[model samples]
Target: MDIFIKIIYAAISILVATLYGLILIGIVHKIYARVHRRIGPPVWQPILDIIQTHGRKVATSHGIMFFLGPVFRMAGGMGTYLFMPVIFGSVVFSNYSMAGDLLLVMYFIFFGQLGMALGAGEGGHPYSPLGIARGLSQMSTFELPFSLAVISIAIQYQTLNITTIVAAQQGGMLNWTLFTNPLAVIAAMISLLGMNMHSPFSLVLAPQEIPIGPPIEMNGSFLGILQTNRALFASAKLVLFMNLFFGGATNLPIMMLKTFSIYMFSVFIGAAFPRFRPEQSFRFFLRIPTLIGILSVIVIAYL
Candidate 1:
């Protein structure tokens, strides 16, 4: 009975997260449109797009792996969301956070990417491979600084459990890791720009050159699954950042505001800058952010 109740709670949490994720994507599109001085789609545009994609009559698949790619992607996104404690101490919103720690969260976040890469290889499209190569290359580059920053925070808190980390920051805003360990925050936020795949780091999607890259061949229902994953994955990443650097929110409204603010960091940067070449993006992450991450580790060790 207890296990069944937990499962029910988990299901509800995922559903809510999915809805919130879609709304956030819609809001992001609206913001992007406003920046360009154009009328934007409705705030519910993402939901409509997903529905249309899912309703399409035909979809092409390239072997079993190609068919499974989007499935793996959705699983990855949902799994990541499930493991995160959404509203700090809320019982129903906790999801399955006890099943994993920060290390597992990091691994789960990359699980979908690896699955998608395999599926892309099976996609049998020349551009798909090219996009995969660029995406993987950039992923490797950014993961260094991001991982190091996470390690620094883990060391400082002496626990890989995200709940405990959030609990530690409860007293005041200054107690947040962002204020207490600015170096790690800086390193992480910089790497986050690449993770978000915004301008300057948007080489992976290179629509003009690669026609939207790895998922180029995916259409109809498959594309809809990928679209759904996009919403959940984006929200999960934002929640992870909020838990690590900003203090985790105690309620739904605060959570939305904090997550949106963190998301805007990438949006504003993407809007103002041009895209970077794959190699340029790689080298950029290796430079300043890497140095800051290393310094953060050293500072934590001394203290």
Candidate 2:
């Protein structure tokens, strides 16, 4: 009975997180539209899109891997969110957090993309592999700084348990890692620009010579699943960042506000900055963000 309750609670948590992500992305489209001085689709546009795509008939299978690709991607998204504690003190939203779950969440972030790469490769789209190479290379480069920041937090907190880390930040805003260890926060925030796949870092999916790279051949339900995973993955990343840096929210509204604000940081920056070449994006992360991340770890661990 106790185990069943946990499953029910976790299911609710995931449902809330996934739906919240979908709505937030619709808001993002509106923001981007305003930034470009155009009226965008309604905030419900994303939901309508997913429904429309799913309503279509799936094409004949390309291969087993192709079918499994989006499945693995959705699994990866759920895997990242499953163990994360949502509202810190709320029993309903706490999810199933446990020791070392942070590491697992981090791994799942990459897992979906890797699975997509394998699946897309089987699609025989020539551009799929081309984009995957650039994307993987860029992901590896940006991940360095974010990984170092995670290490710094672990060293500072002396535990891989996310709940413990959030507990320590309780009581006041200054106790948050944002104030306590600005370097790691800085590094992580900059890396987020890449993680969100926004301007200067959107070579793989943005308006390039070959756009919508990996999913270029994906259509119908295949495309819908990928789109859905994007929302969940992006929200999970934002919520993780909020927990680690801004201090975990104790209520749903606070969580929503903080996550929305954090996401807007990347969105506004995307609007302001020009897109970087793939090589340029790779080089940028390897430089200053990497240095700040290293310095953060060194300061937290040794200083």
In model 1, which regions exceed 4 Å deviation? Answer: 206-210
Quickly count the clashes in candidate 2.
1
Q: Mind giving the per-residue lDDT tens digits that candidate 1 earns over 1-303?
A: 998898998888777778888998788788888989989999999899899988998656589999888898898898888887989999888888888998888887788888898997898989888888888889889989999999999889999999999999999999999999999999999999998887889878755565788898888888899988888888889998999899999998898899999999998999889888899999999999999999999999897
Instruction: Write candidate 2's Cα lDDT for 1-303 as tens digits.
Output: 978998899888888887899999899899989989999999989889999999998766789998888888898888888778888988777777863478988998889889989898888888888888988898899899999999999999988788888999999999999999999999999999999998778876873365667787778999899888888888889889988999999999999999999999999999888899999999999999999999999999898
RMSD to truth, every model: 1.3, 1.3
Worst 10-residue lDDT window for candidate 1 reads 203-212
Root-mean-square deviation of candidate 1: 1.3
